[model samples]
Target: MKGLFKSKPRTPVDMVRQTRDLLIYADRSPDSRESKREEKMAELCKNIRELKSILYGNSESEPVSEACAQLTQEFFRENTLRLLITCLPKLNLEARKDATQVVANLQRQQVHSRLIASDYLEANLDLMDILIAGYENTDMALHYGAMLRECIRHQTVARHVLESEHMKKFYDYIQLPNFDIAADAAATFKELLTRHKSTVAEFLSKNYDWFFAEYNSKLLESTNYITRRQAIKV
Candidate 1:
């Protein structure tokens, strides 16, 4: 009877909506670095962390709450993924890291639970493309690059990214002027090539002649010591 008098927990939908609003506000606010904005950003990070905990806290022995899974499904249903991607480039470093962590967490969640559908990817193919284009924005490169790696963990996503024409852009990305951007791109490049060995093997066998030639000339021979080191390591 006492439980009836207790306050109910906020729904995952409400929590996600609040976090999304905060992020959008932070992005558009001119004085984003102001104390109030910073406070909101901190709250946003806390919300994501809490969502992660809720979605992933259960042990294999314990069944996860339907509410948690519903929240995750709602996150995609609301097209909140687009919100995260749009705000990523504008977020401060710590905020961006937290956001990326949330994305990675959500990606892993689908693997453990069937509540979130794989068809979500098919519906949001543009989100994957946006992540790929993220490299074009130096400020966003690392954050989105991290998200991309997590996204490709799924076999379906890995195959799509592997086969996309965008795969060719890695050669240019690996040689970008900024060390951090170039390095992050190279890391994603390596993951794409090595994560699914069978898939990569087939890709290489099919594209062998020009792929290695371009890789050798563009990355291996680059004047940047980091690029050279990375290419040789690959």
Candidate 2:
């Protein structure tokens, strides 16, 4: 009889839905109520960790591909990604890291052999702008910047970013006062310019004059030693 009251096991779809619900709550929750928000944030973090473990598996078991597919499909199908990005600042450090990894891994998940995350991102390019702008926010820079780099692994998204006005911002982003942020920005900068050779070539060719001018001046001759080194390497 006691076994009849046991909680039902959650499927991957159930996990995705629950995680999305928590993320929405976080996004809408007011910081005025710090204690309650903290409690919800902790729950959100646990859900995110559970999602990660389902996709990546734990030490005791390997990730189930079907579960990963379901999670990925639901994640991109709904507003989960957007909510996570917007609510990131409200989360604790560990939660932010888990969320970041979740974002990064989903970029590679395939649904029915199609890269659906790319499709979702292509339809939601404005999110990229928010991510790029994050470089200016010291606290959110690294996390958003990492997710931004992963998003560009999709050629369409990379092309959008390359053509956007944000391309010019990386020159300063890579030299930000925070070493970790600066370095992460630099890595993202390199990934953008090198990832899809054809798209990058086309962009560079069209914007060669202004782009190279900024590259040679701001990055090559920047006051920061790491900036100069990275510029030369890239």
Question: Whose lDDT is greatest here?
Answer: 2
In the range 11-102, model 1's lDDT, one tens digit per residue, is 87788888778767866786656788778877877777766666656454343666566667777777677787887766667767877877
Candidate 1 all-Cα RMSD: 4.3
lDDT of candidate 2 over 96-142, digit per residue (tens): 99999999999999999999999999999999999999999988998
| Runs of candidate 1 exceeding 4 Å displacement | 1-7, 20-46, 53-68, 111-117
* Backbone clashes in model 2: 0
Q: What TM-score fits each model?
A: 0.78, 0.96
Worst 10 residues of 2 by lDDT: 25-34
